[model samples]
Target: MLEQFGAAIQQVNLSTPVLRLFGTTLALLLFVLVSRALLSKLIRTGIQAPELRRKWLVQTRNGLILLFLLGLVLIWGQELRTLALSIVAIAVAFVVATKELILCFIGSLVKGGARSFNIGDRIQVKDFRGDVIDQNLLATTIMEVGPGKLTHQRTGRATVIPNSLFVSEPVINESFTQDYVLHVFTVPFKRDDNWQLAQQVLLDCARAQCEPYLESARKYMRRLGDRRGLEVPVVDPRVSLQVPLAGEIHLVVRFPCRQGQRSAIEQAILLDAFGSHDFSGKRKEGDEEGEEPSAVIE
Candidate 1:
């Protein structure tokens, strides 16, 4: 009787092979979910060390999870060789089906991983100029700034642009290096306010106002590069003098700026210059409107 009972139990256990397979699959699904959560936490912890690249770690983690799943399916679902072939075929089909999407996703991944730009980066991708707000597999969301001038102070309208831009256009990342820009205030003496003395005064003032910013910018740029594992600084404030249109000598000074500060900086420079000197536009209200006399916007 005991022998017969043990034999019966063995037969019953082997009867539901499909049920066992389903239970194993369920367990695997739970494992994958738990592993993903734990892995994310691990990645966050690892980001503290400066030497380790977070992007590479994330990529490796993803690949490991996928390989684990693929191996499990091949071992438990059916014949290993057949399962392997089917997976390859399916991957090829998926790539062909979503070619454009794959390319865009790859591009975004590269852009993000390299720390090329951040959420508030002022980037001009093709023709859509704006501050980046969101990035994902398909599209990048941006708040449109302007057309010719590319100003960021706007009415809160955002645009969703495709990641794979067809236009072969340049993407300008303003403040990709440093913030705190400079603008020169030209104060021309009316040939009587001691032109040389006035120039000296203005130049000295500009230097004092902008030098500190330049030094700070350099230091910050260096720090940023070091933190991100980038090797160079992409921005520097420069000031110079030139005579292109003919008038009082033009002092050209550029300072670092956060996004959307160009116009404000220009206005501030104008106000400061006016407070110290007389700036009679002299020409008619509209006479030099577009003629662009000795005035240089850049």
Candidate 2:
């Protein structure tokens, strides 16, 4: 192409193309740097529009810099167009060589760039749970929790999930719409114990612990309503005890929790609830607390 187009323009020595390429590249670098600096300064100082603050400068500067680069490239006339077309063909070949990686990158943007989940948001996708540590094109990383406290299968390891998972897996975003989580605890019931009275005592304890969260949920919902155009939600505390599984009464405690604090917070609540209550179906003068001859509910 260079030979074919030589007679259409100024004739040069054997070193002409090399010198022109290097010189044009250097000029482009200088042009880009100068344009970026001036654009950044203008966005920072000249732009006085208060409505366009925080992120306005970066976007404006990028636009100006791109325009400057495009103009600089256009200066080469027809020769540059031919070169650019050849470069585009080579780039297309390169992309075809790594199609999977490009797809992964696009999938990552769709999943992570949507602001769907944050670092501490409690999310369950496929078979993983915990706080997300790092999300990238190839994989999403999480600090796994909840081993045997709630269920038998322990997800105690940091797992890397592929970006394609969002398209297929049912992602349970616990903190997506609400900050308060319902914690259901079930305990065994004894035939000899006064079930109603026992329920009241447990209710009072659960209510006291969950009161702050209920208030928090209300305040958060109101803020969400005002700021994000969301509907206001009311928080309700609930407890259900049922006699089932091996003839044991399950003491269920429903309460609110911060987005990422489910497993640890639940464990803490269980500890405190057990510490304060004598859930033991039998009562003796020297009997210890919560030593009931029934199975414990998670």
Candidate 3:
């Protein structure tokens, strides 16, 4: 009778719905714990490539966690379904609140993956032109350049521009194609100061000082023309005469030069030209001797 009673009790225990569900939940919990341990070991010791390993670990961990959560939902599907509306409403509110921040982050991702431009590159956007000093998720900082005392000169100020603007505005990357750029500067001389001789001297000085840059510029320009169908300009130094003001004829000299070395090249050419002749466009009051003139900008 005791044996019969024990057997009947065991059968009842197996038949109970709540007891069976509890046992199943315990088994699933155990499975999850064991699987998590194995996956962690695999991610820590198995992967070789650093980048791939990081990506794999993140994706796999997230997937596993999701599966674990899904299993729980299956166990408690009725309970979670009741809260689904609240979950979706909270998600929508959060997205709307952080819309601009999210957009900026997306812009940064696009910039990094696309490689639109890089640090030290000279880029112009929205009337702001400068060398990129720093770039982050939200904005880019640049050392500003402009006209007058700021002509191709830093203003000792940093301009921070938002990365989101890159989506709509055009970016002029001067340093993207090559390290050298075509720099044009005009040297003005009085009509009486042998303008013809001044042109020849200036031309010779440019050819000598900018020899290295000229060769590279031509090669890059040719490559651009072939690859992008751009019109390749004449690479050789050219000096053209322009009379934009009275009593002065300007010799516009165009040459390929390093972006960082523009001022140095201009100074060198001016010094060399000054030694040859009095190349001045204007003289100060009561000036007995011819004063050295600087390059003029329009």
Candidate 4:
């Protein structure tokens, strides 16, 4: 009675769906192995050339393996289909859980495709401006730059921004030219001051400071323009006058300088211009307070 009970339980288990699938898979695999062995034997004995025999044997083995995999899929197609549906549902849930992370990854891809900025390049996006120090899939690390745009000085802070910002904001690459860039700054003066003299003083100072590399910068600009089919601007020092208010005048100066030297060059020019007697609107010794200097604007 005990032996009969055990036999009946074993028969019931074998008749279940999972056990039936397993048995079918095993039988299919056995058939594939037998087929492969018979084909290999036939190739080895029938082919006269050694190379041909080896090639046929390899081909037969590969075909049999492929057939075995196909048979497995066919035999377990229902189970595999169920498993695939479950996997897809899990994937959807996971994606919903990590939406921000996915957006960051997509942003990184966008940045790469656009070739917007790179390591050591100065860039500004939205309100953040800095030199890129490091970057990964999730965030970009930059050394903070500026109390403002005119300052062009580092704030000695590191900022890690999420890559997702790249997808929505326009990126300004200050160091796009690599080694040289056109830097602009402004000097304000009172309307009563010697505005003309100040403009000339600033222009002269700029020309003097940039004279050394003016030719190189010009050539670089020309080459870049030609390569990109752009109308390149003149690289010579220029000072434009702007009167935004009734009592003030702004001398806007634009000059070319080496990358990372904009602040220094601007400082040098300001020092030279302010230190000049004519620019300071100060009369020389023994001159009337209201009298203009003997120096004439050329």
Provide the overall lDDT of each model, using Cα atoms, as 2-decimal numbers: 0.58, 0.62, 0.74, 0.83
TM-score of each: 0.51, 0.55, 0.54, 0.66
lDDT string, candidate 4, 1-298, tens digits: 9999999999898779898889998998889888988888888789997645755665576567668878888988988788986699788999999988998988988998999987778999888999887776788888999987667889999999899999888899999887799998988888767676676778899999999999999999999999889899789988887889998878889999998799899999988988764644543455445444233222
Error of 3 at 12 (Å): 28
Residues 100-216, model 2: lDDT tens digits: 677676666677667677555567886677656666557777777666235312366888877767755667765575555555555557655544445555556656666666677
Model 2 lDDT at residue 251: 61
Q: Lowest-scoring 10 consecutive residues by lDDT in candidate 1?
A: 189-198
List pairs with backbone clashes in candidate 4.
none
Best by lDDT: 4
Candidate 2, after superposition: displacement of residue 119 in Å? 2.9
* Global lDDT of model 3: 0.74
Q: Model 4 — TM-score against the truth?
A: 0.66
Could you list the CA RMSD of all candidates, in the order they appear? 9.0, 8.8, 11.1, 16.1
Q: Is candidate 1 or candidate 2 better by TM-score?
A: 2
Q: lDDT (0-100) at residue 199 of candidate 3?
A: 75
Cα lDDT of candidate 2 equals: 0.62
lDDT of 3 at 90: 88
Summed over model 2, clashes come to: 15
Worst 10 residues of 2 by lDDT: 289-298
Give the Cα error of residue 7 in candidate 3, in Å: 30
